[model samples]
Target: MTAAAPRPLPEWTASAVSPLDAKLGLELLEVSPERAVGRAPVAGNTQPFGLWHGGASCVLAESLGSLAAHAHALTLDLVAVGVDLNATHHRSAREGWVTGTATALRLGRTLASYEVVLTGDDGQRLCTARLTCSLVPPRR
Candidate 1:
């Protein structure tokens, strides 16, 4: 049998998919599980006040969990869409790019849920997020 073709992920789904990381100045990285092994830097995603913005943390969390959901759906050729998302900031990163990792709590046929935790360079908690996505039939 021939090898299966590599699947296509959304621009938001792939690693380093940004067309202008330099312009955005984000050294984005993606990792799975929340055990602290999977954390990506935020680079320039900080507020002018010198602390990590809530939106920035949200993006990082969403990116990771969505990736997991999509990858999970790929097994069945399903398309995943984020239906609901939530985040709780436990602390702040005053300097340096923060890293956030996601852990999957549920991966079902119709929905997948993941939890993301962000930490500062000093290894302090910055934020925590939860994302839920719906897996639907893929378009032909």
Candidate 2:
């Protein structure tokens, strides 16, 4: 007997993958088990003070991290669900775009972890986040 091949991951599209992501203007540029990249505009995702909303950063971080974990989980015919997320906003962005890069910290049989960095268009670090997801069989 031979090991079965991993299932092909569905193509990630802003509108198709998540409604919140589409509303927040998030775009996934790349995705893999070890890494994922995404970006969102800061124009509408701002606080009352007109600065980039910290919550938006967290959303992007979790999205990328979860996507990467899901990619890994697919290899085992499992699904990934977010278990924990933590984010620290270091700076604020008033305009332009924010890019998030998620780097896998651990890819395991039961869980996956990633460190996500959100950067401004100027290449300045704006936020750092960590996310963990649990892998399990998909519910029928």
Report the Cα RMSD per candidate.
7.1, 6.6
What's model 2's overall lDDT? 0.90
* Per-residue lDDT of model 2, residues 33-129, tens digit only: 9998889999999999999999999889999999999889989999999999999889999999999999999999999999999999999999999
Measured by lDDT, the strongest candidate is 2
Write down the lDDT that model 1 would get.
Answer: 0.68
Each candidate structure's TM-score, on Cα atoms with residue i matched to residue i, is 0.74, 0.90
Which lDDT value does model 1 have at 19? Answer: 46
Off by over 4 Å in 1: 1-43
Tens digits of per-residue lDDT for model 1 on 40-136?
A: 4454666778667788777767766776777778776897788988999998876666777778898888998988877888888888899998999
